[model samples]
Target: MASSPFLNEVRTSIRVRGMSIRTEKTYIYWIRFFIRYNHCRHPTEMGAAEVVDFLGHLATERNVAVNTQRIALNALAYLYNQFLKQPLGDLES
Candidate 1:
């Protein structure tokens, strides 16, 4: 498969902000997982509903712990809120 400049851009953004290597890796991991979970579509095409489903899957089906779920939410928030600059409004309901 071809490379995704988008992921590279995300990585660059994280590094430019002086985030740790581990944090970058974790963020990238979740971002990638989110894309793959949604059938490899670009994140720009997704929105809050997609995010809600992913988080719900993590909580109900995957049975991830609370902190793990929070980490996933944080990763996605950074992707949307910080990198992509697309707000996922009222996601915490």
Candidate 2:
């Protein structure tokens, strides 16, 4: 995926909020993965359904562990809640 200033800005925002570097990296990874999984669509142009799809892929295809699924969910929540200011309600993750 192309490097995005938007994602960089998300990292900065996480840093500014006193998140650890590891947390920043994890969040960025999920954000990038999400965007790429959605054909590089901007997060602002997507929503909870896309998140469900990604997480579903992890479950049914990648067989990601439970904690891994949770981490992905958290990252998406941060993306929508903090970055886009659009909180996803009742997301199944």
Candidate 3:
């Protein structure tokens, strides 16, 4: 999956911005999870509504900790805002 062009682009974007390797890995992990959670739909094809659903799933279905959900939200924010150049604009968190 790391070899995929989209993931590679993500990696490149992270590195270009001087993000730590751990941050890179964490962001990639969450991004991949998000993609898989949405049945492999492209992030560019999704937006705030999808993000809201994923976060809701994390809280209600997966029962993740609040901080964990925040981390996932941060990863998606970076993916859209930093990598894809699309601001996610005031998500519910």
- The top-ranked prediction according to lDDT is 1
- Stretch of 10 with least lDDT, candidate 3: 1-10
Highest-TM-score candidate: 2
Model 2 poorest ten-residue lDDT run: 1-10
Candidate 3 residue-wise lDDT, 1-93, digit = tens: 435789989989999999999999999999999999999999999999899999999999999999999999999999999889999997766
Deviating ranges (above 4 Å) for candidate 3:
none
For candidate 3, the lDDT comes to 0.92
> Model 1 TM-score?
0.93
* Tens-place lDDT digits, model 1, residues 53-90: 99999999999999998899999999999999999999
- For model 2, residues 35-84, the per-residue Cα lDDT tens digits are 99999999989898999999999999999999999999999999899878
Instruction: For model 3, name the residue pairs that clash.
Output: none
lDDT of each: 0.93, 0.91, 0.92
Assess candidate 3 and give its TM-score to the true structure: 0.93
Q: Give all candidate RMSDs, comma-separated.
A: 1.7, 1.8, 1.5
Residue 53 error, candidate 2, Å: 0.7
Cα-based lDDT at residue 14, candidate 2:
97
* lDDT, model 3, position 84: 90
TM-score for each predicted model, relative to the true structure: 0.93, 0.94, 0.93
